[model samples]
Target chain A: MGRFVSIWFRYLRTDWFSLRQPELKKLPFVLRSPSRGRMIITAANSVAAQQGLHCEMAVADAKALVPELQVQDDIPDLTDKLLRRLAEWCIRFTPLVAIDPPDGLLFDATGCSHLWGGDDKYIEDITRKLQARGYDVRIAMADTVGIAWGVARFGNGSLIIESGITIDALVNLPPEALRLEADVTERLHKLGLHTIRQFIRMPRTSLRRRFGQHFLQRLDKALGSEIEILSPVHPVELYQERLPCFDPVATSTGIEMALKELLTKLCFRLQRGQKGLRKAIFKGYRIDGKVEKVEVGTNRPSHHVEHLLKLFQINLGTIEPSLGIELFVLEAPIIEEYLPQQEQMWNESGGLEDIRLSELLDRLAVRIGAHVIHRYLPDEHYWPERSVKLATSLQEKPSTQWPIKPRPVQLLPKPEPIEVTAPIPDYPPMLFRYKDKVHMISKADGPERIEQEWWLQQGQHRDYYRVEDEEGRRYWIFRLGHYHDKIYQWFLHGFFA
Target chain B: MLPEAGVIMILNRKADILTELQSDILRLQGFRTVNNGLLDADLGVIKQAFPNASFPLSCIHEFITSQQEHRAATNGFLSGLLSSLLGVDGVLLWIGTSRYLFPPSLPAFNLSPERIIFIDVSKQRDVHWVMEEALKCKALTAVVAEVKEISFIESRRFQLAAEQNKVTGFLLCHQTKKISATACASRWKVSPLPSETIDDLPGVGSPKWHVELMKVRNGKPQSWDIQWVDGKFVPIYKTVSLFTEQNQKAG
Candidate 1:
C-alpha cells in the first residue's frame, strides 16, 4: 500500500527574505532581534547563535554581537491568508487540494501528476513558477505523510524517501522532526534521547509507559509504522472555475472582465457535462486584505453566457472592492438536462401565439406593476358579481365563457337610488326624480321583468320599465321589491336611444 | 366687424350673379315663383299636378329603369328645390301613403335622412299619437307619415303638429280621396319635362321640370316651369323666337 504523506516547510518567512535577494540564496546568516516592544528574532538556525543573542534578549544587546542582524515582527495571520490564496491558485494542478499549517499545501497527486509530465516534473514546475512570482517554496516527496513532513522541514539536499523506506529516512533526524514540543524534546534529551533513530530503537512498551501512547503513535507514523489521512481544504464535489491575472488588477472594469472570462469557462464546463446552472456565485479577491462576493439567480435553467451576464449585471452594483481584485472565481449548482423544443414549419411562419402573449404580459407587468393588470374569467356561480373572477396578468388565461345571462354594454359599478310616485299594478311610476331631475312620462313602454337569481338568493324581485319623457328622452328605470311593500325602492338603471 | 363686412361683400357678389341669372330666365314668359319659401305649398302643388313624378324610396330605387328614365328626363330638376324646402324647421308629413318611392340615379343632395320620420299606421286611431308626438317636438324638420285615410279632424291635427313642431306636413292623399277634396294649404301637379341633348356630351343634359299650380290658399294658382342646372332651379322662359325655334326642333 502507498503511504499517505504530508509535507510542510519551516522558515517560510526566511525563505521569503532570501527570495527577495536571489544572490544570497546560499549565504549562512541568522535573523535576530530582541523581544523588546513586541519585536522578536524570527530566525536562528544554530544553538550557539541562539544562546549568543538569547531568545528573549533586548535588541540593544543582540545588536552588540551581530550589528547587521535582520528583524521582522511575526505576522502569522497575513502569511496564512497568503498561503490560502496560493493554494487556491494551485487548484489547476489537481482538484484534491488541502492546506497544511504555517505555509504548506498538501496536494493528492496520486493520479493527477502524470497529466503534468510526472510527479517530479510537476513539483519542480510548481516551485519554479511560484519562485518566479516572488514566492519562496520548499517541497519534499516521501511515501509516508509524517516522513515527508519531517524531510521537507529538516532533511536537506533533495531527500526523496521511496515507498516503504520512511523509517530508514527519518531515523537520522532529531526528535524535533517527529513534531514534538520543545518541552517533550527536553525531557527526552534528559533521558539521553538525541535522535529519532535512538528514540525508535528503544523498547516500545517502555516508551509508551514513559511518554504516553499518543507520542509513540506520532513517532511511529513519522517512521512509517502507521498510516495517516488528510481532510482536503476543499471537497471534490465543489465545482469552481478560476482566472489568474498576469498583473495585479486594481480597477473594477478589469475585475469585471476577468469575471466574464471565468463565467464563460465555468458555463462551458457545465454545458459539456449536459447540465444547466440555476445559480452562480462570483468571488473577487484583492491583493490587499479584502474579499468581494456576489450571487445571482435565474428563473429558468440556462447555460447561455449572455443571460448569465445579464443576471450578474443586476448584482454587480453591490460588490465592493476595498483595494483591488486580483483573482476571480465562478461556482454554480448544476441541474439535469432538459430536451430542446422542436419547431414546426407552420409555427415558423408566425411563432406561437402563447409566447407572444407572454411577452406582452411581461412588459405590461413590468410597467404597470404585477398586480395592476388583470384578466377576468367566469366563476362557477349564478350571481352576476360572483360569476366573474379576476387574476393577475402573469397567470395563464382561463379557457371558458361566462355562464350568466348576457349583460348590457354598460354596467354601473354600483346602483344609484331614485324617487318614484305612482300606482304600481297598472304601469310604472308616471313621475320620477333621478340625478336631481324630475320628469313626467308622456308615452310608456313595457315591463321587461328580469327576476333575481333565486338559487343565489331568495330575497328581492325587480321590475324594469322603459319610459319616454315629455321631451322624448328615454330611460330604463327599475323598482326593487313589489309595490305592496312600503319599502319598495326605485332606481334608474340605464338610458336608451 | 371687419371680417363680417368682408363676408357680406362676398355674399353680395354671389347674390348679384343669382339675380342676373333670374332676370335672364324671366325675360321669357312661361315661368313663375309661387309661395316664395313655403316648401309644403310647392310639394302639394307639384304632387297634385303630376302624381307620376319620380321619388326615391330606398337606396335600391336608384337601380330602377323607370325611375332612372324619369330622373334623366328631369335632370335632378326637383332635387335642389326639395333640398331647399327640407332645410327648414318643420315636420314634413307624407300622410296616407305606404311608401315614398325614390328615383334611380337621384343625385345625392347630402340631405340628413334622420330628419324625416316615417310612421306607418293602417288604423286611423294611431294617427292621434303620431300627431301628438309630432306636435310635442319642435326640433324635427319634417314628418312624413302614412295613414289609411284623413278627415277634417285629422287635417286639423296635421296642422296642429306642423305648427307646434314648426314643421311641414306632406300629406299623401289616399286614392279614395277626391283630387279637390282634402283641406291642405295648397296643391299642384308635377311631372318630368322633355329631355334636352347636350351640345358637347354624348348623353343628354339633366331633366327639366314642368309644374302646374292647381290650387293656392291665398294666392292665385299659376304653373311654374323650370330647369335644374348645377344643382339649382332656373326658370324657363318662352320668347317668340325661342318658342318657334323649340317648336321647329320638336317637329
Candidate 2:
C-alpha cells in the first residue's frame, strides 16, 4: 500500500510549474507527484464524479474513469521561481506584495487595479494572459487572503463570497481543502465527518477534543470565521542601504571607513536612479539587537560623495559603535533628481561662465539649505512687494522683463510704521513722522488705490501717495482702509527717487 | 629783391597776426574754465557752484580721520556732491571710499541713483592701477579718490593716468597750510561756511570759501574770496559788514 504524500504547492508556486492551458476549462485534471506517486485531482464538473475520483483511486484507474484526463508532474522549485516572477510583476500593480502558499499571490491592490479598469477586468486580463501562456489558473479576490485562496480553489463562477457568505461558499468543500493533514482528515472521517460542512456543523468542542484545535482553527480561517493577515514580502521603500561586515570591525575610524564605502555604493545607486538626496540616513545594525542611525541633511539635493562624506564627518564622533556594527544601511528620504540645464553652446561666449555659476549655486545650496537660498523672480503683480518672488535656483530662468514702474531702489523688508495725523475723508495723512524725523509734505501725488485680493484673507486695501518733503526727499506711503470704529492708519511703505 | 620783399611782407603781417593771436588766447582762457572751480571742488562749493554740470561729477575730497563722526561728515559732504552729480547723465566712480558710500541718501545733487559705481581696492598700491582701467572706459565722466599722501612720483603717475584717457580725476588730500612744492594745478580747502538765514531759521546758507590756487600752470596762484550761491561761485569782493555786525551784536 503506497502512502499518499499530498504535496500542496499552496497556490504559491503555480506560476512557476503550471503549464498554460485555457482549453482545460471544466476538464478533469490531476497534478500527479512523480516522486511519491500521489495525485491531486484538481478539477471535476460534478460532485459525484469528484467524490468517485477522491475515493483513493490509482492514477491509471482515474484516467480510465475520465479517459480524456490531463496530468502534470509536480515540480516545486520551478513553481517557486514562477511565483517570484509573478510577485515582481505585481509590483507594477501595487508595491505591497506577499506570496500566498500553495499557488496564490496576495496584493494590497487598494486604490490600485482601477488603473487596469476594475478589479474584475484586472483579474480577467491576468487570467487570460496566464492561460494563453499554457497554465491552469483560477482567480478569486476577497477581503482576506484565506477566503480568497479557498474561493479560488473550490468556489466556482462569480465567487464574490460577499461579506456575509464566506462560510456558505466554503461549506461544501472537502475538509482536506481546509489545509488539514490527511491523517487528521481520515481520523475525522472515521467519526463520520467528511465534508467541511458536516465537520463545521459538529460541535466545536468535540472536534477540538478529538482532533486538536488546529484543524478547526484552520477551518475557521478558511471560512472567514476568523481574521487572517497576509504577511508582506517587502515593507515600505525606506531610504536605507545596508552592508554586513564579514569581520567584526571595531573603532570609530573603521566604521567611518566602512561608512564611506557604503555611502559611495548608496550614492552611486541614487545617481543611477537620478536622485539627489537631501537627507542621508546611515543605520548600523549590530550583532546585538541594537541599531544606531545617523542622519545628515543637505541644503540642496546632493549626491556628491565627498560633500556628503564631509557632512557625515562632522557627526562621526557622536556615534558610539558599542560592540561594533555588523550591518550598515544608508537611506535618504528627501530625494530629487539632478536636473542640470543643457546649455545650447550656440553663442559659446558664456559657456565656461555658466558652468562656474552652476558650481557656485550648488556650493551655496549645500551650505545654506536649498529652500533657504532663493533667487529673485519678477512676478506679474502690480504691488511692489508682490512684484518679486523668491524662487528656488534649480527652476528654469524666467524670460520676462522688469516692470516699467519707477520703483524704489531698495524696498524695506516690511512697511515701517509712521505717525500720521490726517482728516477722515482724505485718507492721505497731511503730516507724518518716520524714523523719528517729521516730514511736512509740501507736494503730494497719487491716490493709486490697490484693491485687496479677496481670495487671500491677509491682503490689505490701500491708497498710496508719492509725497515730496519740503527739501524734496520723496516718500511712498499708504493708508489702510478703515474698519469698525478704527480710523485709517498710514504707513510709510517705501522711498522714491 | 626777394629778401627785401619778404621783409616788407613780414612787417605788414606782424600787426595783423598779433591781434589775431591775442584774441585767440583770450577766447581759449574763457573756455578753459568755462565752469571754473566747478569741476573740482568740495560739497558745499559744488552744491553752490556747478549744479548743472552733468552727473557723476567727481569731487576729490578727503576725510581727515576714520572716526565714525568723521565718516558721517564725509558721507554728508559726498551726499551733497552726489545730489549735484545726479542732475546730469554719467557714471560716478568713487575709488577708495566705495565702501563708505550709501546709495539711498545720494539723491540731493541729482546723481542718477543707478549711475554711481563703486570699486574698492585692498591696498593703496592699486590706486593708479584702477584709474587707467576706469578711464579707458568712456562710460564714466568723473573718478574720485582719497589719497591724502601722494608723493611726487604717485601724483605724476596719476596725472599721466588721467591725461592718457582724458578722464577727470579728483584727488582729495589733507590741507597743507604751506603750499606743496608739486605740480597740482589748483588746491582748495573747504571749511563749513556760515549758515544762511531764512527769516529766523538758518537754512543751509552761503558757502564761504578761501580759495587758494597753490599752482596755476599757465598763470599766477592768488587768493580769491568766493561765495557759492544758486549753484554758482561768485567773488564776494570785500563783504565784511554783515559778519562784523553779527559779531558786534553777539559781543
Candidate 3:
C-alpha cells in the first residue's frame, strides 16, 4: 500500500532565523510583532517556553518572568523565502514535495521506500538528515495526506500507520488535528465531539447544520475514504546546475571561479541540445539559507560561454556573500533553438558592428530597465496616437513608409486649448492667446480640416493651422468644431521643429 | 563673427560667380550652412537665399537658434529646416520636456512621426546626459534636444560626440528666460515675417520667415526673408522698397 508523509516544522520563524543568529538559541528569546505601543510574542524559543512563556505573551509579561529575554520582530516574507529554499533542498528525499506555507512540507511517499528497505527506514533517513542540518522536524506517514498532516502535528512524532488502521489512529487526536479553527474546535468540544472519531460518527444533517459542510469535509479527508491532492512547488528553470562548496566561498574571486565552472558545464549541455538561453539567473545560497540572486537577459539567444560570462561580469557587484555562500546555482529560465554558426572568411552584412551594438544595448539594459530603450514601428493609421507602435524586439522593421509630408519631431502627449482672435470666421487665427500669453500670428497657413474619427467616438472635429509667431517659432494650433459655431475653441497642439 | 569668405551674398538679381565659387569651395571643405546653396539659373524661378547653399552632413554645426520671447515661431522654422535631415533610414532622437510638437503635424513636414522617438527627461542634467549618449550612438540618423539652458562645455561635448560619430545634431534652446552664448559652427536667429498672399486669394499666403545668421563659425552672416513654398524654402524679394525704387526711376 502507498503512504503519504507530512513533515511539520513547528517553530519555523524562530528556528529558521536562529540558525543564522546562533546565540539567540541559547537564550530565552521570542520573536515579537509591534502592536499599538507594545509587543506581542509571535514565536518563542525553547528556553522561553520552558520559562512558561508562550506565543502571544505581552512583552512586559514575558520580560517579568525572564528578565534576560531577547526580543526580535517577526519577518514573514523572509521566513517564507527560507522555507521554499529548504523545500528545494528536500527534493533529494522525494520527487514530489509540496510546501504547506507558514511552516510545513508534504511529500508523496508512494512506492519509492523499498530502496531504503521500508517506510520506517525511509522516514528515519529523512528525519536524521534534516535534524543534522539543525531543523526540529516531526515525521508521520499515513494512507492519506490529511491524516498524515494531523498525526505529524498532534499525534506521535513518528507514527507510521498501516493502510487499514488509519481510522483507528485518528480517533484520539484533537479536533484541531482536522485543521479546524480554534473557534470551531471550542464549539465541537462543547458538544462532546473533541476528537475526529466523535465528529465522524455525528448525524450528517446535524453536523452540517452546526459546523456546516466544511467540518464534514475535513473529517472525511482525514479518513482513507477521501483523498487530498498536494500541489508540489516546481522550480522555474528546466536547465540548472548547482555546485556545492566544500568550504564556504567568501571572496569575489572564489565566486567568479564557481560561476565559471557552472557556466562551462551548463553551456556544454545546452550546446548538445542546440539551445541557447535568453534569460539566466545566478543564485548564491548562504549557509543560513538566505539567497542573493542576480539575473541578466540577452538581446538574442546565445550559447557562447564568453558572451554570457561578459554579461554577468558587469553585475557581479550586486551579489553580497554575507557569512559566506555554500551553494551556487545557475538557472536558465528561457531557451531558444540556436545552432553553432560557421565562421565566415569575410565579414557579412556588417554583422560585427551589429553584434557590438547589441552587446552595448544589453549592458545599458541591465543598468537601466529594458523598457526605457525603445525602437519604433509605424502603424498604418491616420490618427496621430495610433500611427506608431513600440517595437518590443530589436529586429522589428518599419512595415510602412515614413509619411511624406511634414510631421512634428515632438508630439504633445495631449492637446492644450488656446484662445484665438481672427478678423474673419473661417480664416486662420490672426492671433491666439495660450497660457495667458498672446501670440500675434505673422503667417497663418491653413484651416486644415480634420473630422472626428466616426468609427471611434472622440470629441468634435479640429481645423488645424500651422501658424508662425513673430519669433519665427511655429505652432500647430487647431479650432475644435466649425468657425460658425458660437462655442468654437482653439487649441495649441504641437511645435513644428 | 565669421569671415565673409564663405557667405554667399545674393542680395541682387544678378549672379555673382565669384561668390558662388567661393561658397561652394567653403562647403566642399565641410563648412556648416544654414541654407542649401542656390544657383544663378534659379534667379527668376527661385529667389536664392545663399549664392550656392548645400548642408555639410559629416561635420558638426551648432547654431545659436533663438527667437522673440513672446512668440513661438522657432519651432515652425526648425520643423521646416529639420525636414532636410529626416530622409535617413535611421530613427531620430528627440529629447525634451515640453510637449509642444504634435505627432500628427509631423506628416506636414514629410517626416514619419513614428520615425522620431520622443524621450521626456525632466531634469536638465539628465537631458544633456541622454543627448550625449544618443549622439555617441552611430546608428542614429540625427539627435535633437530641447533644453532651456545649454552651457558652453555641454555644447562642446555634443559637438565632439557628433563629430566622432559623424551624426548631425539639432539643439533647440528656449530663449524666453535668458540668452547665453552657445558654442557651435553657426548661430541663427529666426522670427516671423508677414505672409505674402498668393495673387488675389482671400486666404493666408505661404509661411514666411525672417532668418538672420547671428553668428557664423566658418561662413559670413546674413539675413533674408525666406518663405516655405512647394516643399522647399524660397527667398522673397523686398517688394515694398523695390516697387518704390521702380516708381522713382520712372519719374
Maximum-TM-score candidate: 3
Q: What C-alpha lDDT values do all the predictions have?
A: 0.53, 0.55, 0.71
Candidate 2 Cα lDDT to native = 0.55
How would the candidate models be sorted by lDDT, starting from the highest? Answer: 3, 2, 1
Query: Residue A24, candidate 2: how far off, in angstroms?
Result: 33
> How high a TM-score does candidate 2 get?
0.37
Candidate chain B TM-scores, in order? 0.52, 0.56, 0.71
**Superior by DockQ: candidate 2 or candidate 3:** 3
- Candidate 3 residue-wise lDDT, A295-351, digit = tens: 999887666788788778879888899789999999999998875562121113222
**Candidate 3 C-alpha lDDT tens digits along B1-251:** 34453353443323566676777887698654443333122222222223244444434444444432212345555665556565544457777756455555555644555556566655677668778877776666677787777787888888888877876788777653555565555555666655667685543456566666544444435566777676576777543222233433432
Task: List TM-score per model, in order.
Answer: 0.32, 0.37, 0.52
For model 1, give the RMSD to the true fold.
Answer: 32.2
lDDT of 1 by residue, A195-266 (tens): 887867778899889888878878877765676666666533456888877777766687678778887887
Task: Give the total clashing residue pairs for model 3.
Answer: 36
